[model samples]
Target: MSMNTLPRIEGPHADGADPAGWCDATRAYLPQSTWTGLFPGGSATSAAKALLDMQMLLPGEEGRFTRRFSRAVPGRPRLYGINVDRVMVYKAG
Candidate 1:
């Protein structure tokens, strides 16, 4: 619940990619435990930040939206974009 720490994202996380391609890609990786926490409601700033983080949208001329999440290191906080539900929505262009 901070002013501008990190924004929760919105939208679909995956699109125009091989959906099942990532399945066997991690075949040789070790498995670890992960926990999830969901904050359904948040502040305006928080929501804005979340929208930015999720959208990862760049400032444009007008009201054009463009961006997409990444597959590589999707959870890295340094990168900003929308978290399309459970998936990351990175900027496309």
Candidate 2:
């Protein structure tokens, strides 16, 4: 599966955020299966550029990308959402 970032609600850490929570949440929901090693896709910047290329930003316009936690833990701030850009390939046999 190919991974990509999904639109998220703006939060405090709008610039950058850890993806551990998102990964954990996804793994939890996904069915258990035998998996193979992960392969590199490309840099986030390249992905971002591809997104931007789809549209024309105003001169000097800047775009922002953020990845936040997928869920909240007790006493911890809700700082994450969903990220769709994380692609995973596995074999089931």
Candidate 3:
């Protein structure tokens, strides 16, 4: 696919944000035939639900996931923030 036709994915950030909305936005950029393949056995909403459920079982961690686009001019790269999941920990001495 050409750079102009590349697909973009994003996640919810605000309180009460709908997860399905994020999936819908991503699905909009993809071809209809690829939707099923991209989100096998389920729609975007179902996929998001499954992911959230799985994340719940994992240990708390913090980090930033970054993405960069191919530069045409060969200079400083641009970084895109994908998602940030922060877990707070309080330790008492």
Ten contiguous residues minimizing lDDT sum, candidate 2: 28-37
> Each model's C-alpha lDDT?
0.28, 0.28, 0.30
Per-residue alpha-carbon lDDT of candidate 3 for residues 3-79, written as tens digits (9 for 90 to 100): 23433343324444222212122122222234345567657446444534544112212432122323321231332
TM-scores of the candidates in the order shown: 0.17, 0.23, 0.21
Off by over 4 Å in 3: 1-28, 48-93
Instruction: Please name the candidate that would achieve the greatest lDDT relative to the true structure.
Output: 3
The window of 10 residues in a row where model 3 has the poorest summed lDDT is: 84-93
As for candidate 3, its clashing pairs are none
lDDT of 1: 0.28
Measured over all alpha carbons after superposition, the RMSD of each candidate to the real structure, in angstroms, is 14.8, 12.2, 16.0
lDDT of 1 by residue, 1-93 (tens): 121322223323354422211212111111111001122334433543455555432322233222233445344222222233323223232
TM-score: which is higher, 1 or 3? Answer: 3
